[model samples]
Target: MVELAICSSNFTDQLALLSFKSSINFDPNNVLSNWTQETDFCGWVGVLCSRRRQRVTGLILRSMGLQGTISSHVGNLSFLRVLDLRNNSFHGHLTNEIGRLLRLRLLVLAENNLTGTIPPSFGNATSLKIIALARNYICGRIPTELAQLPKLQIISLSDNYLTGPIPSGLFNILSLSYLLLDANQLNGQLQAFPNNSLQFLDLRFNELSGPIPLLVATNFLISHNKFTEIPLALCNVSSIKILDLSHNSLSGVIPQCLGNFSNVLSVLDLRMNDFHGSIPTSFVEGNKLRSIDLNGNQLEGKVPRSLATCRHLEVLDFGNNNINDTFPYWLETLPELQVLVFQSNKFHGPMGSSKTQLPFPKLRILDLSHNEFSGFLPTTYFKHFKAMTIINETVGLRYMGESYYHDSVTIMIKGLEIELPGILTIFTTIDLSHNKFSGEIPNVIGKLYALRLLNLSHNNLVGNIPSSLGNLCSLESLDLSSNQLSGKIPSQLTSLTFLAVLNFSENHLEGHIPRGNQFETFDNSSYNGNLALCGFPLSKECEDNKTQLHPTPMLHKEDDPTFACGFCWKVVQIGYGCGMVLGLVMGYIMFLIGKPKWFVRIAEGEQQKKGKRSHKGGNRNGGRRK
Candidate 1:
């Protein structure tokens, strides 16, 4: 009887497994091909059975490209402990029957097409510890019953359509550690929580408002919201590592105690805020700080020299601020430093020559546009931008970041501000436009082969555009407009195949524009205000010495409207001369016949008519082309 009872239980479990296999309408990988009665159900591809009872305890079918709704019969597997179906196309509402698995601990369905609200019956699964359903379309408020789970530790439902304020009971769960609810529509002010086990809390990309409540976490992200202030209690948490409060309306001066966080913090992002006052200048030595972004703020004062203590620093941005200071050449000592932005500030004085031979050796991006800096381009620094000049083809693409914090930077590309989520190692740019700098662009700039965008416009710079710039094979946008640059557009520039946005407008450039490659794609707007520029795009045609010496006998399609009008005048002049000769000949004959007076009157009338006709034709021909 005992053996028969065990066999019956095994058969029941197999039936439930088969039910799940039947529900999957599509399995392109054929992962469940051998899931049949001929084979032992315990031997199935994703099946895991207990040794004693031979009962299915786990179903690990993650990332098999499986598509279909999960079968409700899955709840019949009473001994099921792990149900992982992550990174699949599993769709439709989650089966409420899954809540019947009393032994279920881990339920992962992340990166799927699953929709509808989470099953409230999940509260019955008391054994559940982790419930990950991130990167799905799951909507509606998080069920408060989930907090009732005695052992629930992680609730990862990020990148979903979940709404409503977080259940206060979730914070009360002593075992809960991570609460990832980012990229959702959850609104309302946060309530104070007395939890101590919570370590990683991400509520970014949401509509949460009001003052931030008391919180203690190692990694805290609450950006892209309307939070107005940072609780002083947050600074008291000495164990914080990553604190990103960027893209918020948080005002007032940054707390000085934040500098103390450098000892443990690796990333401290406070960008796109209204925080005024000078940056904290107490970054201690031996700090683990890797990325520090304080851009788009109203902060004023010089960059503190104390930052040199952060030997691991990689990214440093202070763009679009009120800070006034000269170039901080001392920053070149840091070996890992890559991105340094100070665009749109009161940074005045010359970028004096670096005393070191290889200053900013690893620097890939250097933006100082819209400043009061006046001098020639920093040629010496250009020579030492080893990161931009060298290409490590062996290394695959990578971004600058530290742990969970992906570094971001804002740059002006083609007259628009664009924010990059992460800075790739190979991406490079040099923007020094809208300054009082004067002098020729450096030829050494050509050596930086990895350069993508180069903006040197709106400056008092003079002299020829560097023909050596042709060597920048990766350059996409080149803006050298609004300068006193005079010379022929270098024919060598035709080699830049990747050039997209070219602006040479409002300059004294005089020559036939380059015709081949990407240059041919530019329009008259690119060469506007360059009166002497002539090419296919422009109405003006380049004149050869012969074309100037001898008038064109006929109008050409490529001829300028003004030149065609002149040609018309010349033709009229020739006809008028011939008519006069003919009239004189006629008069001579008429005079012999004593009819000279009538012939003279006819000739004068013909001359007046010819003049009127010529004047009308001139006006029509000289008008600007639409």
Candidate 2:
């Protein structure tokens, strides 16, 4: 009788498991195919049982592409301790019966389509330690009962629709370490968090406002909030390493107290704020700041030369500010410097570098546009742009931004100034437009095959387009308009198959536009101000007599009469050759005759006619032909 009872209990657990498995709408991985009565429950996949009790203790179905909702029958597995179903397509409200699992400790339903509110009854499961339901469609404010779990260490409810102020009791959990509640509709001022042991806290992209609490976090991201200034208590969090307080209306000068964490600070982003006054020059070297973005601010004064001490600096943007100073050439000393932006600033003077060592050797994005920069472009700088010379496809495809922390930059790509958070490392560009820069563009710029944008418009640049520009096969946008550039456009530029935006307007360019690849897509606006340029998109035919006779090629249209072959073409070619030979013979006979009487009379008549015109001009303005 005892053996039969044990068998009946085991069979009851199997029935519950099969009932939940049947609820699945899709199981592309066939994870539940072996969950049948023919096999022992312990031998089934994703079902772990005890060695003696034959009861399920763990059920892991992470990233199995499983779909459908949880079944209430899962509560029958009284011994389950771990239940993981993350990174799947599971939907529908979570079964309230999950609260029946008194022995459950780990419950991860993250990265799914789960909806509905957290069951208040979940408080009965006092054994729960980790509950990660992040990146889902779950609604409603977090249940107050969740704070009752004495052993709960982590609660990740980020990237969801959870609303209302975070429960103040949730902060009372001393065992919690990681609390990420960002990218949601949660509101209200931040409440005092009593748990001092929390290490990672991210409340970004929320409706949080008011002063922040004094929390010592290793990685804290509270940006995109309504805070008016950096928390004064941030000075107390000596353990802070990654701190992003950008995109807020934080006014007033930056706190000098930030220098206190010189030994622990690695990433400090204070971009898109209202901070004014000179940047603090109290920085030290051991901080390991790899990225510093202070763009779109009211900052003035020279770039703190003391920043040279940070040898690991990779990205620095101070564009769109009132900063008035020469270029910070000393930044080149930092080996990892990759992005430099100083556009729309009061920075002036020629950007010529004389150091033997290449300045900004690893720079991939250089934006000095809309400034007062004068004189010729720094050709020497283009020659040493080794980073842009090599294509880094993997950097944009795999790693969207810098390692460890996200790197943001505001640049004028394709024409408008846009801010890109987590900018891809492969976005190679050079924007020197709307400046007073003069002289010919250096041929060395063509060597940067990885360059995606090249904007040199609205400058005083002269000389013909460099034929070497054809080497940039990956270039997508080329803007050289509104300059003094003369001569015909380089036919070699047609090789850039990826060219989507081209502009050569308001220049002195002439001759036939290239007819292949991207050139065929350009409209008359691309060559508008160049009155001498004529092609398929322009109604004005080339007036060169040579082209009129031979019609070399108007965009090399195949249907042109020159490309036809027939009796008329053959006769024309024969007549042209004969006329050339006969003209040479006649010229020889005239030379032998030594000035024929008819020729002399004709020459004298032409000279007399010229003398009459000269006399008329002299009579009109006293011999000065105005």
Which candidate tops TM-score? 1
Alpha carbon lDDT of each predicted model: 0.79, 0.74
The prediction achieving the highest lDDT against the true structure is 1
| Candidate 1 C-alpha lDDT tens digits along 1-626 | 98999899899899998999888999999999999999998899999999998999999999788999999999999999999998788889988998999999999998777889999999999999999998677889999999889899999997677899888888898998999988678888898888899888888877889998886777888888779999989777788888899988999999888888789988888999999999999898889988889999999999999888878888999999999999988898887888899998899999989878779878888899899998888888988898887544443345566544577666675576666555655567889999999988887887777677789999998999876777666667889999999998877677666677799999999978877768778898888999988866888988851222212223243222223222323433334222222233334344333422233223223222112112111211111000
Off by over 4 Å in 2: 1-8, 392-396, 400-404, 544-626
Candidate 2 lDDT by residue in tens digits, 1-626: 98898888888889999998988989998988898889887989898898887889998898888989988899988999999998788889988999999999999988777889989888889999899997677879888898898888888886677788888888888888888887677778777676877877888777778777666667778877777756677777788777778777888888876765656777777887899999878777676777777878899898998788777778788888899998777777777888888889998889876475776778888999889998989888898888887654334222223333467666554455555444555567899999999999988787776677799999999999987777775577789999999998877676666677789999998887766767778888788899888876778766652332222334323222222211223433333222221232243244233423222212222212111112111111110100
TM-scores of the candidates in the order shown: 0.85, 0.83
Q: For each candidate, how many residue pairs have backbone atoms clashing (under 3 Å)?
A: 0, 0
Whole-model lDDT, model 2: 0.74
